[model samples]
Target: MALPIPTTLDEITADWLTSALRQSEVISEKTTVLARTVEVLGVGEGFAAELARMHLSYKNGSGPATVIAKIPTSVEDNRNGSELLGVYERELRIYERILGEIEVSTPRLYYGDIEVNPDAASQLERIRKMERLPIWLLRLILWFLIRFNKGKTFPSVLIMEDLSPAEAGDQVQGCDLDRAGEALEAVALLHAATWGDRCPQERYWLVSSAVAPRLFHAGALGARRGFLKNFGRLLSDHTRELYESTRTDNIERTIRLHREVPQCMLHGDFRLDNMFFARDGGFRALIDWQLSSFGPAVSDIAYFICGSIDPGVSEAEIDALLARYHRALESAGVSDYPLEDLHAHYTEQLLLLLARMASVDLLDLGDQDGRGADLVSVWIERLDARMARASSGR
Candidate 1:
């Protein structure tokens, strides 16, 4: 018998919770969840799902009070992208299947499923969904490129043990040096465990080898248009000039560099908001596995340090952070990857990350007031400073 992905909070029964947990050995076979109060968890950043924290009442004394459920997003516009990119599919698979084979701290999976469909959705998913194709020949060519797709549109839902006991690092305020160090440790362990782990690569549904590779390619086509739109508000005249001069060439080079680095397990979206810290100063879990991939070590490292640099992190200090990551990697038995090579990779990742972050056409920092706006400003501030320093040959 196949299980269905629960689409809403009301659908999750105490019996289902008991069955799932008992299977995972989180609870004894005799133990069971009796009731639960579902509190929808964090929002304002990740748009893929409505995260609900379930406060449970158990029949037995040993069971936990809370578990987290990731359901489909409330935002209609974002749903298409989430589904098309298989975001939920990736996260669910990681928890239910892949994470068990790796040594990383993530929410313990209670239940997960990518719903099955017998439809031929993937055959024409790309070309058939094309909007206003003027040329028949071009449309036909695209349709012909992708041969056969048995892929169905599946709703990937995941339920995991709640980590609400820990504090999620703030992406807006950014992590300080100490928190950043903890994040590097979390990332190093993730990479080290799966540096050459063949488990993920064997899965056919997990084809995206890097985080949002399609977006990177599409964004490249429209880079100038989007960057120019948000340029005036985010940059000084000098920094803007500097950004304009090297931006295109750098993105071109770095995208290539990003693809060419040694492949390993990556927590693709390793930002502050996605990380939780225990009160004892230990990193708890890395959430939002939508972007998990086999890519460069610096892919995750660069992504984390870039967003988590408090208010003012000097370039030298940023370089030192990369060094800290290298040391941790070596501690985890990763040998021969020198700090100098890591530094070069970090620089390229930072450049590519900045260009992509700033190059989105729809990022109106004004629409989102408060912390959202503040995070954008901080990102742009860091971007401007870095570009300016590079231009000055500092």
Candidate 2:
């Protein structure tokens, strides 16, 4: 029988590692985790989950000396938010189902499992049936439902290769041009590989459209409100107007238009923070699949360029990066997508990304001292600069 998925670091015992690694064939049956030490990692980096680096000792045989373990966040609000969006399930499904078939550089998965709350599923179903309810009442009910579902155990786990010594990109610091080019090329590889016929359709849940629009509609109200509350001071007159225009109706229209484009796998959260750079100054791995979904390929590129690049980065440099990404995609055999079309798609995607930025408030950011707030502020500032430049015809 399978061992229960570990929901907390303490629950991730040596026995659990032995069993999980064995089941995943990361270790021979003769090799058992004799002892292990777990060091909590990603203190302020990961919002939807908690990560730990586990150093291990084996008996009878050899195995990976170190690995990373990911479990659902203990932060009550964050965990509940993750459940509401099916974040944990989506990530587990990606690692278990999609990663193997793709060429994107991701951590080697050792084992992964998720036990979604049946009660949560039923509750969502009930809410879906109540679409006739007044919008205000439905939003209020969902707000309370999110609070009520707090601290519920929806255990999910992933044990995977540890890309140690590789530095995680800092969102607040932003990415330099060379590194940005590398990251863009990497994402282009993902988009090109998953383009058109290669897109996954068997798992409808992996598509962004699979989730009911009402959930996003409800969430956008709070997201916009929260974003305004936190970063309104940083907004310029032009930027503030743009932010305000991301009303639910506008956001829905943006989403509808994006859906009209040819779809590909998007590393939905493709920002510097979710990437790791090898010590040799090369791209190592992309982490955080919690937001993986199928969408307009440029959506990922637009999100990264608008949110992750240094705000001071020149328009010419940004264009160079985009052209680099386009060249990489062409090299990878995605011939039909023209550079001009990519730029147009990129512009539309940036607006959608602006609306999506508000969703950052959905996670629990209070515990990060001030880094969480600072990160969001920096992202908005960078994006605002880009939009301002675009509006000025520069």
Candidate 3:
């Protein structure tokens, strides 16, 4: 059995650092970290965990001076909900099991692990044992207190190289023209690397939203309703109607269309916030693998384009971007997939993409400024284009 996920910095001791360092091959078995100080980094967009920069002055001088640590957030609801969904472990497994196999650039992972919770229901049991009172009253009080806890026993943590020293792209302002192209190529290369590879999809960690049939319609409908409630004020009447028309069970539609060709792993979320760029206009890495799984690879492209490129970038220009992506995929050894097919997949995934941008909780996105407005405006613009194509019956 593995230890439960560490929820606080206190649990990540110097001994744990030395062990993890040895495992990551950062230092030899003879080296040891005599002391370490953890500095919590400022929270970034959609931060589901604590981001810390560790200052490690090693006695043997064989380890890094700085590294980033990822642990579950102190916010109980966020922690518990993400825990229930196994997103934390999903990321850890990617670093542990997938990164080494792929050609895509990501920050070097140092140490990561997840374990089952032992005292899982101890909190609830303890609350029940609280002093005698009316059962209903006691229950309600306990609920409020327990709500601050992750509720379940899933504990997980990850530590990797600090990308803070590198350039972190902003999701709100989005990436620039050159940056967007580099980002797209990075995506294409990654998809090509795992194209038609069945092992990843077969992994127990893979969670394909499109294949999760049990919750498709209910989730889609909820997503539709959520979009309307959260973003209606930000949309135009015609654009809103255009979005409403295509809000059908997107997940089901995606699965149907995606199966037409070989499916590969997708960056379920490929927005700018998860991107890091080199000063020379290349994608340094794609981070946040919590949503990495199998799907129509074009979903990653569409998601990136929607929020990345400037709103002024035309559909034709985006078509060129797709062409660039297709060529990159080919150069990466993925052959015979036509640019036409990529375009079609990109167009088809637009509806689900629309429903998603419209319905997902606005706050969860952490994009509420000028860039967010542009993202919605541009997304609806694409929706309008989709309507025109449908009207022409093309």
Candidate 4:
């Protein structure tokens, strides 16, 4: 099936939603849309797409509640995949049939369909005219487009329970050894519950085969190369050696490790932004399952540790977080694996991380304050040091 060309926000309207929801029987005339806000969160340079979030308030018979709407920029900005309605249709099927059954915390999906918002039409036109503008200028224009699109018509939009980022912000500030541990524990539980001997590998393989190629082709290699070039200067001599070693390894070893390693359901994107913290000081949910797949357990662990933890965090703190993760894994019935084996697995996976990390735009130093860069450097350095120590002993 061909990919659906994405629709613009201006293309979405309330009538479209009303009609779609009527088919689903979730909302009716008694249901009123209170407020609507459009937010362009980020843009994907790799896919040349944008990530947007829509905040909507709706009143059912009793009162009012909020919902979140996500519309990929490619659909809205590029109009590339509209022809393939099945893209989102299949995603909805996965969410309802497979992901919904899993233990992982995800936002409640209400309805998803394709339509256009009239309010967005004018702004999107203006944005299109300003195509030659600098990125910062374009971003400003998009932000304005979001503000202008608010309270206008909503077309077909993917709706889910609205989650606030405030609590998550608080969690980052309050981050300590314990909170880090809880997050890792959550990851372990998610992995353990989703995949095991009891689960059908065919189901996951179906999704993986469909998705992995796109990811690899869609700037995965380019991203890795970009990250290395931009940040290679930060790596110590030891870290550089490990980076060089991975280049010498053949694809056979990479593929063998991927196949032989214990497989588990993966939260393909486990970065901090995708996770939500509850008001009561625990994980509320994990969002953005678009990249969910089956892969090595260490993939998720390495991504989280290297991507989320602040660089300012001491090595001692990192060690503690690692311990907490192991404890969490043990509690989840994943105790058979040795710590040394787990670390080695994580080390071997670093090359993959190095490859993928560079392609995407990381949270700015303002957002992560060199934390992500620091973690990556530290991992490289530690691996290099360990390899050297081993060689000396040999």
TM-score of each: 0.81, 0.91, 0.80, 0.67
Cα lDDT over the full model 4: 0.52
- Per-candidate Cα lDDT values, in order, are 0.66, 0.79, 0.67, 0.52
lDDT of 1: 0.66
Compose the digit string of candidate 1's lDDT tens values, residues 1-394: 4555566767777877777677667789788898878776665666567787888888864587788877777455455445555677667777777787877888877767777433324523443334234334432432233222223345656778778768888877777787788789878988877664432573433543433344343443344565567555767788666555554465355547645666687777888888889988888988888867676788787667656675367877777777778888889878857788887676666556655664344332335465545666676665665554445543
* Candidate 2 ranges with C-alpha deviation above 4 Å: 117-138, 150-152, 202-204, 209-214
Please tell me which predicted candidate would have the highest lDDT against the true structure.
2
**Residue pairs in candidate 1 whose N, alpha carbon or C atoms collide under 3 angstroms:** none
lDDT for residue 21 in candidate 2, whole number 0-100:
89
**Ranking of all candidate structures by their lDDT, best first:** 2, 3, 1, 4
Instruction: State the lDDT of candidate 3 residue by residue for 1-394, as single tens digits.
Output: 2334566888887888888888777988889988889887645455467777888877765777788888877665556545544577678888888878988889888888777454433433342344334434543543343345435555567878876556888866666677788888898878888887642754446655454432333334444555676556656565566566665556456667667856788888788878888766568998888877777788788777766666566667777888888889999988868888887777666655666664344224344553445555555554454433333333
Error of 2 at 78 (Å): 0.8
lDDT of 1 at 36: 79
Candidate 1 stretches greater than 4 Å from native: 13-32, 60-62, 116-153, 196-202, 208-215, 220-232, 242-255, 258-260, 359-367, 370-374, 388-394
Pick by lDDT: 2 or 3, better one:
2
Model 2, 225-343: lDDT tens digits are: 87788777777888777666666455465557556677788888888888999988999999998888877888788888887887778887888998999999999989888888877
